[model samples]
Target: MDEVPGVPAGLLGGHPRVLAAAAATGRLPGRAALDDYRAAGARAAESGVPLRVLVETALVMAESMDPVPLPALRRAVSALMEGYENAQRLALRQEEVARREFVDDLLQGRADRLAERAEHFGLRLAETYAVAVARPAVPLDDGSVRDGTVRDGGGVVRDGGGVVWDGDGPARRIEEAMVARFGSHNVLVAVRDGGLVCVVPGSLTVATGEFTHHVRQMFAPGWRVGLGRPHRGPGGVVTSYREATGAIELGDRLDLRAPVLKAADLLVFPVLLRDRAAIEDLVTTVLSPLREARGGPEPLLGTLEAVFASQGNQTAAARRLGVSTRAVTYRLERIRRLTGFSPDDPTQRFTLETAVLGARLLEWPAHAPG
Candidate 1:
């Protein structure tokens, strides 16, 4: 690059190599915009565009009309500047293409590797991940993501940026940056969508509880998240993704705090059904009538557990039963009325607590032994 004549000696800029270096790599930090610049340069180089054109343009832009003013030379400089403009526009378009292609390749290569890493780290890729998609602060269409920010793992679930995400602070910050980039409100950052997903390893620890808590705080209003049931593998992500989406919709309908759903939560109903067999018939039928007819009759289940637990201490039993001394007396009188046993008697408290536990488990209605 030549110095423009009559321009101050210190005003030395427009070195093509310097521009290349600045645009091609980083001296400080970088933005996504910088990536475009680099991509453009790479395309220009690969397309066999002559670097001489770029270099010559820099020389023309650097020249100043000082002591020697030539009209033809000035025209040449103007033509060169215009050429630079065209070159820059070409570079920008090429950079955009390069970015899309790069994102495609990056996502493709990284998915399986993420699966492998999750396995090595004891995160089951088969286990469902909570997909939380986000984009820039701008509104993106449903299932949209910015290039380089989210890599598509295919079919509505994108595996997270495993290695790329490691030292970049917590994944939440990455989501926040994406939001800023897209200039969007709380956008769903999912695979192919504004989905920000967490591969919640199937293993449930106390920390998983904490994970759920954090998941709830991840978004603001007008954004939705779908937490899928724990799936078996990456393929399972599709189903899990569907489940979480359904859950978010359901939560919206039902006014739930967190829209994420877990497969295990559904098992509670089944377990309750199965346990009822042991509870209903074991003790309630055998003891209900006797307790009601006793002279020292009490609510047999409550009194029995208390007395047996207290080992016949009237005071302690009364405290455990949440009753006053006089109430305890009245109830105790009713207890002996039917069961032919006094709670004051030591041997009887044993049978009483056993019966109490049985009745409690059965969820049987209370009775005063006659």
Candidate 2:
């Protein structure tokens, strides 16, 4: 008789029918053979047999033991189930450890064998991918908030207020939800730095708006999402992750009310923030005059914001500000006189618009030291 791998040799030696079943299905016998099956499960776990395969083996073993007395076989099946559960748990735990290590490597850009490691973690490195970062929208009332910077495992410091997420329950729930929306194998989620970061494949074809809407509905209110644009390859994934992080930081700084923010929509902020000295200079040179306006900077700043938001259309700006078009035009004229830059000119408009964005990001007059 041919020997079955990982199965004890002498255990099924006497039963020809059981031996044939084991040989054909790669399942151990059952009933009086419970001990051997349990042992086989342990060996399989150690040998790296997949949990799904082990489960099927257990079911097949129960079916093959049908000729045994019903009550006795039922007891044996119960024992087999326990053994399978233990083996699966052990395998799953080990996989989790390996997966965490891979994620850390990926995030840190230290993964040399990217393709091999990604495949081991059931990820397709070559596929188009995007990264998303989600955090609890509501700050904890407890004074546990830390004042310093919060950095992820990858050592990327996301500039935002920190929250101490105390448990894995929410993270796990998010992972399950993402897997349900995008298939289990296509999405990899890990909780890092008190937030959930997910690497999801683009093959799911879910639109960004729809994806964020679904995520918001799945979680509790006040959950904010930062989604990155899709890019190809593992390096692209890292880039997307950085974009997602930047989106969150920018959104928070700007006090954007939208629950979901896309990185692509806010690329200009990062570019402007890249040169701190330059942005500060621009704000000082163009907007400093507004601080000395007749009614103080608030009214002029409000007018400027309204006009820019309305795309330089004085009529639209006036409607938004609940004032007459002539009033809006007069404010724009005052702005030009004070700053020597007219909002109506294309070149000056670009400069003023950029400066306005910089002021918002820096919290300008509000950021002035007390």
Candidate 3:
């Protein structure tokens, strides 16, 4: 084996040695050689060695057996190669399974030897980590994934719960892009609960921007990305993941138009939702009068939302609503007259804006509980 040209010392194994002996004997190796080759292939896959190199080395070993019949040697090498390929496939499947399990544990905050497992995947539990989650604006299909086999729009529905996607979907593409930008060691991308989750060191200020860039490339205007603040330790991964997921869900509920949302920026929303009774009461009391308007609460509600969104500028609100400034003024007056809350007064404006946000959050009038 040492005498074989172009064969690295680390790659020298019983399989090649057995094949050489069989070639010298003008016969192919039996089962033992096949088992050795399979083991070698698994090692090669783990060490990042190319199969082409292995094949070329085998050819060199075959060539060295001068005056020996080539048929037996060729057959021996063929058997060895088959074993190698089979082992490589097995190694790959096992690697994928390990990765999936590690990601699930990390994101779900499962602490069963999680710190030790994190090291296996190149994660440093001492460092702070942030999570970014992304999904298509419109889900691939309306079907629920079952038995870990359903694939929709490149997403797989996990049997346990939520989408667990794989293959050549947006998740794969995003993973590739992120790895290309940040290097594989710096980022971990996985499909969990039906969306793509990217875990990157929180210190990388541009990480989320890079994530957003890649997501936008694949799903412009139709995708949403939620970013969670970085937290330290293994549990931090789970915390950040939850924050990212929460941001995405909140954005959906609030009808937020922004493609990118940060959990830190929307902190007030969770606070508002914490006391549901208080918010519901606020919405019903301050804005209920608009229900009596000619077109019901929607028109008046839109006026308030637009006015507040425009920072009290009637002209900008009008532009947003696609109505004339005079119309906006009239609507504002109608709201004041109907609800006794004026958008022009500073204190009243604050109360009106909070109620309006609560209304959107509660899906008032249209879906609010009767």
**Clash pairs for candidate 3:** 156-165, 163-193, 163-194
Candidate 3 lDDT over residue span 1-370, tens digit each: 4644444565645544665576567566666666666666556655666777777776775565555556655655566567566566555445556777889888877888888877776788889999998877645322234455545456342323443334456667777888888887788887666566789998986988888888888764677889999999888888898898889888888777787899999899889989999999999899888888997888888888788878888999899889999998998889899889998899999999999889988888887745
Best candidate, lDDT: 3
In order of appearance, the predictions have TM-scores of: 0.30, 0.63, 0.79
Better of 1 and 2 by TM-score: 2
TM-score rank order: 3, 2, 1
240: Cα error in model 2, Å: 1.4
- Mind giving the per-residue lDDT tens digits that candidate 1 earns over 202-225? 443332344344444544444545
Model 2's TM-score against the true structure: 0.63
In candidate 3, stretches whose alpha carbon ends up further than 4 angstroms from where it belongs are 1-48, 64-86, 138-165, 367-370
Whole-structure CA lDDT of model 2: 0.67
lDDT of each: 0.43, 0.67, 0.75
